[model samples]
Target chain A: MARDRRGGSPPPTAVSTDLTRRARIRDAGLRLFSERGTEGATVRDIARAASVSPGLVRHHFGSKEGLRAACDAFVLERGTEIKERALFQGELDQPELLLMHRYLARSMVEGSGAAASMFDRLVQATQLWLERHAPSETPDPRGRAALLIAMELGALVMREVLSRALGSDTLSPEGSLRVARAKLELYSQPLLSADAAARARAAMDALGERLDAAAAGEGRPATGAGDPGG
Target chain B: MARDRRGGSPPPTAVSTDLTRRARIRDAGLRLFSERGTEGATVRDIARAASVSPGLVRHHFGSKEGLRAACDAFVLERGTEIKERALFQGELDQPELLLMHRYLARSMVEGSGAAASMFDRLVQATQLWLERHAPSETPDPRGRAALLIAMELGALVMREVLSRALGSDTLSPEGSLRVARAKLELYSQPLLSADAAARARAAMDALGERLDAAAAGEGRPATGAGDPGG
Candidate 1:
């Protein structure tokens, strides 16, 4: 059955051909969707971008919403892929955070990915995934681990924001690289020494306990230590 | 002569609209800008949103771009107002990190200021501003201090990105609020204690110096921490 570009179900298959075709469709979708936005983009626009027929899009996905769903998955999987490759490059607990930041910066500053508008959808998907997987029992260490990892990445963006608000300008490519490197370096050091990491974990655990207690109190619990909350 | 929104030139002080009309125009612009992207929106939209005529929109803003530029400034300024107010609310040595975070989150999550997509523009604008101003420094403590403050606010959006990437489904109101609070808690902690902050800064500085040494030295740096980069 042929599908319209507006939305449809992707064809079911385990073969290489199917995988390659799916990739083609997703790549095209990312470019067009980012450019036109979710509501603005049409299936034909995506098909044209992918060099595939509209029927092929329809034949694979059930509808426009389905294609969007697939695109969401594709962007996410790619984000995961970037995370993996950046970390795998060398031995440092963190390869230069700047390098990783650069990789993301490339996606955000240079390409179709720069739209940054799609972030809303990605966030929504993240919530649904959390609900399904973060079951009560084991703490879902995997998801928790990913969340903490993400906080570090967020640090770079934070640095950029701070720089701009005060400086009235953005980080040039080289400077951003330098600052991001500095942040990543700072983030990396404690981890390098297992002794320090254990100490840090203990401190964090204590702090978390205090927070839990304070939160339970009549009013909001005051977090101890330096306020990183700003 | 009519004044332009980009601050090209203000009309002579003698030519003035009553304060009420000025407020009405700014209000109308904000409403339209949030609903329609800065690009998608027109003067007609602003006027309509304000229940005024397009001529009135021009009379107030001078042109479509002018209105948009003004709107952009308004959104940025409004978001920063609470922080600016709160900065003076506490002692000079250390401020309440939780309060700061709450103020920022309240602005983004609750304000009439542009929501997420609109925020995409604000975040990028801040980055743009950082890019321009950060390297313009001349070893002045004032510049550095200002930059640090800006970096702190930047952390808010940065943390949001991190929480989302980890698959927590942080896009919705509840999830976004939850993640915002967590990040607020994390980043706000440092602002509360002077000694803790001094130590953290010392650590970051040392790490930065070491990174510089490493970069000056050898081959590629180690891979970054966590699964994304690894």
Candidate 2:
């Protein structure tokens, strides 16, 4: 029951394993989660596939839920950040956002399946996150932030599908990011100005806090749900 | 089968059913299509829910596939038209773009099941459309036009899911639209001045005759078949 006690570095655990082994667990988790559904995959299965002990998995993640959450964060937060950076490698020279969009698309379609699997899990998890993270204040956190992330992920994947259909081969890290960039440019007009994007992001952070509180079953409900598209 | 002949202008054989009946069928179809995946639902089921005859369903559309195609057109083509119109609505005054985006969001989220179904169909249909419509000439229509439409549809749906999680019930067609417009602006930045959108769109029109046609299907083949994440 001793802790690794290492700050910054993932601590040593009760069960034997390494960082790469943990990644394998994530890789295995993404595949199973995407194919069956986040709710469908079990921790034991992921551990076995990763060639690790279930005890090790538990020691690392604390629980199956913890592992799922970690996988979601890893794919969406880290992967997207990485892909975005990769896409705009030289936006100034390219000038054409579409070209950059095409390049980033490579990350989604042709990127490692591990990336794609984590992506699938993130989309589904966004909902659960809202459920878990809703604020306790009145009115919901206004899922605008969640939706933006969702749209980004969906667009990323759809770009992959469209690329393959268009005959761009080998959905890979180096494939037609130019084409993907061009495709992404189709979305440029609607982008929030830097100021607006900031405000929106802020609103989202505030909303997330509210959602977390509310989902905890405390606080005034937000009036944002007055909509009745039903 | 006897025609409704309700219009009295003529015994409309093609769209013979009145708007009311057609509306009923569409509403029923949209609902069922959402609940049941494309492969799972049937015309009989749709007609039964609409309280109409299967004959009417068949008469309105040649078959189940045709009906589904019509549904896609209804959601996608019509939705795009709405989206494009909203782009300019707020440019003048009152920030109408926000309303427009919200309205678009409603169409996307409320129409989620339909949008999801449309996409599944579109994924395969894009291929068929290319095959049948791809002209055997020297000018290839730009491949990205249909792809653009498809991507936009995904964006709209993505935003709706966001609205759902944040519990933003005010996700009107107009409000959601603003969000989409903002995103599209960022997406299309490079093309705004250059008329790239226009050129790309026209290319799609001309591509039929002169597609790269590089030995049809010569484009890269998908490598690493089967889920790589595994």
Candidate 3:
């Protein structure tokens, strides 16, 4: 059943025939969980959405919590597969991929232990990707990867605001492309001049040192010394 | 009373002397709202946290909704002031600034009319900042700014996941600096090589054209043509 679901990137209309009943339930669970969050979606809701019985849902996944876990696992696996294809094969226009991204974003926002684990896995993957493919040198590769993941997922989490700003729904194809293009533009070119970045880095380092000194009970008060206008 | 709160970036210990009861309640509201979201924090809770009576809370802000509006306005104004200072004056180490960022992130995640308005204001501010300070030439300056803001605020929203990835609390000064350093590193350099970026852009453009063509009922089905493995 899992293999059937994972085997093909079937069209939405073909989903009914391509997936097993269990896969259908899981897909419904993912959609509801993504849209309404875990607490908002009950077992009956998932069963109804899947056009199955509540008893069948329990028999397959045990409970709502179990169903969520199954959804989490499925999403993580599918997301990894889609991301790998996009990165290595340059296959960027997968429709199911976007749904998976949305699911992951919603899952992370409705945080749980599973979400944290998923985030960590993504960060590790990003860090590895950066180490292998990135042209620029980074002192803290982990932090950079984590930041990148947060920013990307953040866009999904705040899609409504982005859509409002762009006067279109970011989850839609056009808006997604617009966002992607903007991201490409931002990443392909340096936003800050080299000189300014150097100065900012130096200032941050100095501030970090000051913060360290303050933590050590140095001459400056920890919380009050740099009170901008006070 | 409002002036007392806005006048100085007093130390935490001096909060009592520096802010009036109303200001204290507002500040407390901001903290709780930021931490707990709009629904999680209550009027009685805000009053207790501020060490004031519920009657005084009502006298000052009328209701929780009123207090929230007051918080939204105060945060927006203060956020703008801090951002302007940070951009123009290069003062990036203000402690209160982080709290404001936290509050806005929570507000945005909670999603309300006020949150949408605040997001619009932020996008506008970012667009102006990009025009003035960003060296890169962007075809869609609004989209770029909106993306940048989403990414930055997304960091705050997903701070817990980020903290776990970094093994430190991102809200803490040290962790914040680490994240800042990483951001500077990222912003200062192009992640994609010029050749790769050009290729990616070309591919995206081709895909966009195809999507437009498909949307217009040309050569392809809208939903299923590019199903990687199907």
Candidate 4:
């Protein structure tokens, strides 16, 4: 046979077909799961949507839960690729910022199933990225990441709510980016003087140690693992 | 008729019965609407859940939309009462603050139905309340109220997402409130010295005016009334 122009030889028909079938099922599952929730969609529903036999779904993914996990991994990888690429340039222009907000907002609202996991992955990626690029010595990196994520997520997830509350469509891409940038810039300015930030950090550190000890005394993990009230 | 100890006269059976039925239907609608979205629920589902006949639902509510409206009004009123009461004591203790955050978070998540409208109403109520209680001359009160609402809603809605992202249970009432308060305290300290906030506000004002004029030229309302993109 003639060599493939794309480079590598084509996989065996059986293997390629298997890959296609699995991907079809995964993509179908992602759409449905994103629209409804994981709990809301059934294996039969996904199989039917994917135009595949239910037995095939079980054969490839084992169970509905397994399929969901696969979908989560797939979507998270796709989403992370986009986000990392977008912020890779270091500084963002207006369009780039808007794109970031839009992607994040969509992921947040389509929050059931893989989207939720995707969000967590995105945050981790973002935090790691922030640490590498904008390494801070004064403001705690983790705390700063949490705040930044909260602000971005808030703008996207609550856009309509914000629009209604603010008497403007603050959720619109342009509108949201504008407000978000302003707020981010404003917030980036140290709310407390450097001395105060250090003092606050110290106080929080002490509080955290005490809480951890208290939790340990109660035979619970310090990071609130045993707290059922959450 | 026998005299009633609790009142001057007993309510007629028909009126009281009607009131009881209406209230029963309303409460059931509120719970269902909060749990699912307005569109996700149906008149039959609500009536069945309420233990009332479908005919009764239509007789009382006119339609499903009508019932949803009633539910929105009811939930909003209840929520506002709790929030206003929480803040009424001037300053909030941790518990009080937690309560406020919990209520707001629930409202934000239950947003697809009446909660969206309720958020707008809450913002209006909050703005009015702030103007009366903590009138500010330097920072624009309306802008400040919008920012505060955005921040609170952000924390609540994204708490789970935040928790997942931050590798902590940010949704735990106490934990979330603690982190939120710290962040809030930090944010409340003027991010920008007085001058920066004014400058940002001015820039936004000019942008707003330009958009408003453009909207007028297009024979549309300035505040994005006609934009369907959102």
Candidate 5:
């Protein structure tokens, strides 16, 4: 848990040899799962990556699903820890944090109960962050937070395409820095003028009202038309 | 291609019965492919969805891969047409446009050559739009555009989670309007104060220089570490 000069966590290699076998297996699972996804990375692949037998992997986590759950729990816990350190302690340059981000991105794209839970946790955390630091006049704060998180996760999910678009791999340290700088630039200034935003907002409001009226005339529930939840 | 009173394209249902069998198969492919990933949807499922014989589907599109390629081409062409109409003619209220967006989102997440091509096209289009509408002092306009496109597509890719978070399906007309409004609000106002953004930019600059110096000292290519492309 030693902090480097920049207050970031020590590199993974620094403490790699000291980890227990179970911890090693979990770390391997995180890496493989992030890189190859849940289906692409088999138990045999994880076992080989960890320099352990397939049976030992089962002994440690029961099955691939169990291994994934362990990985998910580890990612959630470690990701929160890293985020707090980065936010509160100014440990923002940690490279290992990307692994957690990648794992979560894959999980989110794959979609599962675990992924939904992770996404909800992130939305809640982002909502809290917005309220505390970047408070806004957004009426639907939860929706705003959810949208913001989706945008951030979207970059990770579309990392390959983004990397190509940027003429560099976004996950690399230099490329990561470049992307971060670009985001800082983008968020620092409003993309639309106040007049434009107000006009767009008004237009959306008009559309909503018109749709509601049309639905009422048709004798149908306005919001229930395309409820994917049903 | 008759326009509605609002300047949007006619709804899909209006032309559904007029479509040829080939067109029907292609449309079904687009819908199924968007809902299910490339692997998740099969020729049989697509044929069933289209109410066509599986043999007919094969006769028209050759195979599932061929069907997907045809769908990709159609999405790109139709998406561009819809986008142009939306931008130039104010046809922004078209609900069917969501189908194109969903298909592209799924393709982007699945990551094939087609997906990469589609993403690059989007990045290019976005970069053009930025240059025309919201020019900034960003040194890397391509990177900025790529990030913007990723954020937008990210919303579509994570639509289900976003819908759950917002308590409504984002793909629906009402939910789409809400999401659009939220985006307008977000883009209209700067998320970070100028002072904070400047501070972050300066910090990132310092980090970059430090990393470069470290790389130089180590006699390694500065940007070569962790290059996923390599």
Candidate 6:
């Protein structure tokens, strides 16, 4: 009965074929969704894009909602792939960083639900990376991770904004990448150093302690404790 | 003839009155425009918001376009004020920084023309600041300035994004301030150090020189001069 459901294919033993077909459907869905949006792109359109029958789309994913979720996962995996390549495979050369920034800039402004979710996932990935890689004694890894992600993505768009402000087209593809590399080199010199990262982590911990103490004192009579003389 | 246009008011020798009236109109325009957008808000709506006559709105700004431009200028000036206060008036306390960040996060996502232009002006101000404060020997002040501004504003929104990613309400008034203080403490410890700043400036100059050399070789064919072995 199951094999018959798959249009009389072999007894469902071709796992590789099934996996490849699913990937094809997802890739096609991403393209169509990016072009026309989820609501605008129909199941038939996605099937045509993937060069498969509508039954294949239905068989692989129950509905458009499922297909869209798969597309989101694919985009997130791509972001993770970029991060891994940059982290483990030696230094990320200028071109490689450029590719990552371009993708990010595009996604940041895509205004689609998937693009928004993809960005969220990237931030979460940064948090996870910090937890695993940060010094065991590091405090406020979440806060530190947020700062790193902010600077990384910041280096991307700031290139364009600065180019516009400075009355130059340094924001053109090649030029922006050049500017981005220069900025990254400047920021990363300190941020990437083990000593600096540790120092920053410690600083964050101290600040958090101060904040917590201050919060606790809200009910205390401030006249004495807050006074410098006291 | 200009004096005659005034509705029986003094000859407008009082510069203070002119300034006050202009500010009132601009403030009203900003509020209305932010709430309803430029096209959605009318001159009458702005005048009503300001408790002035429609004629006064026209008198201060020739049309809706003029009013909107003034609003942009106002927003830019506000941003500059925050930066100046934070830089000069000792360390920016958490609340002060939080206030500025809230305004920025709101402006960045406003999707209004005023917001976009205001952001542009803020970038320009950052460029000017770097050119003045960075080491005299530093090259590519514009690029460096852009990097600084990107980090600054990126710090602002990344707080919100981080809160969202962590599923914490770090964006609530007090919570956001706490989160912001932690991140700021982490970034500022190194950024405020004279030694780090000087090192960063020197590195920027070195990268600029490297980039210039690479660009100069773009049109040259592969030859003995470019070959590492040669």
Give me the candidate number with maximum TM-score.
5
* Cα lDDT for residue A46, candidate 3: 86
True contacts kept of 2: 0.11
lDDT string, candidate 2, A113-163, tens digits: 344444444444543443443212223222333443444544444543444
Model 1 residue B183 distance off true place after TM-score fit, in angstroms: 4.6
C-alpha TM-scores of all predictions:
0.44, 0.39, 0.80, 0.55, 0.82, 0.53
* Regions of candidate 6 where Cα sits further than 4 Å from its true position: A1-74, A82-120, A127-137, A166-174, A188-230, B1-67, B82-87, B90-138, B170-174, B181-230
TM-score of the second chain, each candidate in turn, equals 0.39, 0.37, 0.81, 0.54, 0.83, 0.46
Rank by DockQ, descending? 3, 5, 4, 6, 1, 2
lDDT tens string, model 5, B142-183? 888888888888888888777877888876767876777777
DockQ of model 2, rounded to 2 decimals: 0.09
Off by over 4 Å in 3: A1-25, A39-64, A85-91, A215-230, B1-26, B39-67, B85-91, B218-230
By DockQ, the best candidate is 3
- TM-score for candidate 3, please give it: 0.80
Against the true structure, whose lDDT is highest?
Answer: 3
List, in the given order, the native-contact fraction of each candidate: 0.10, 0.11, 0.52, 0.20, 0.49, 0.14
Better of 1 and 6 by lDDT: 6
Candidate 4: stretches off by over 4 Å: A1-75, A90-111, A125-148, A164-168, A171-174, A189-230, B1-21, B41-56, B90-117, B124-144, B163-173, B181-230
Instruction: State the TM-score for model 2.
Output: 0.39
**For all the candidates, what are their Cα RMSDs to the real structure?**
12.5, 15.4, 7.0, 10.4, 8.8, 11.2
Off by over 4 Å in 5: A1-25, A52-62, A219-230, B1-18, B52-59, B219-230
- For model 1, what TM-score is found for chain B? 0.39
Global local distance difference test of model 3: 0.76
For residue B172, model 5's alpha carbon misses the true position, in angstroms, by 2.5
Per-candidate DockQ values are 0.12, 0.09, 0.34, 0.16, 0.30, 0.14
Candidate 6 local lDDT, B74-180, one digit each (tens): 55666567656766664445454444444444344333455556566655666565444333333455555555665655544444354555466654534544454
Residue A40 miss distance in model 3 (angstroms): 4.3
Where's the lowest-lDDT run of ten residues in candidate 2 chain B? B221-230
Q: Write model 5 residue lDDT over A71-125, tens digit each, in one string.
A: 8887777788886776677555566777787888878777755777778888888
Model 2 C-alpha lDDT per residue in residues B100-192, reported as the tens digit of each score = 333333333233344444444444544344344332222222343334444444444343344444344324433443343334333322323
DockQ of 5: 0.30
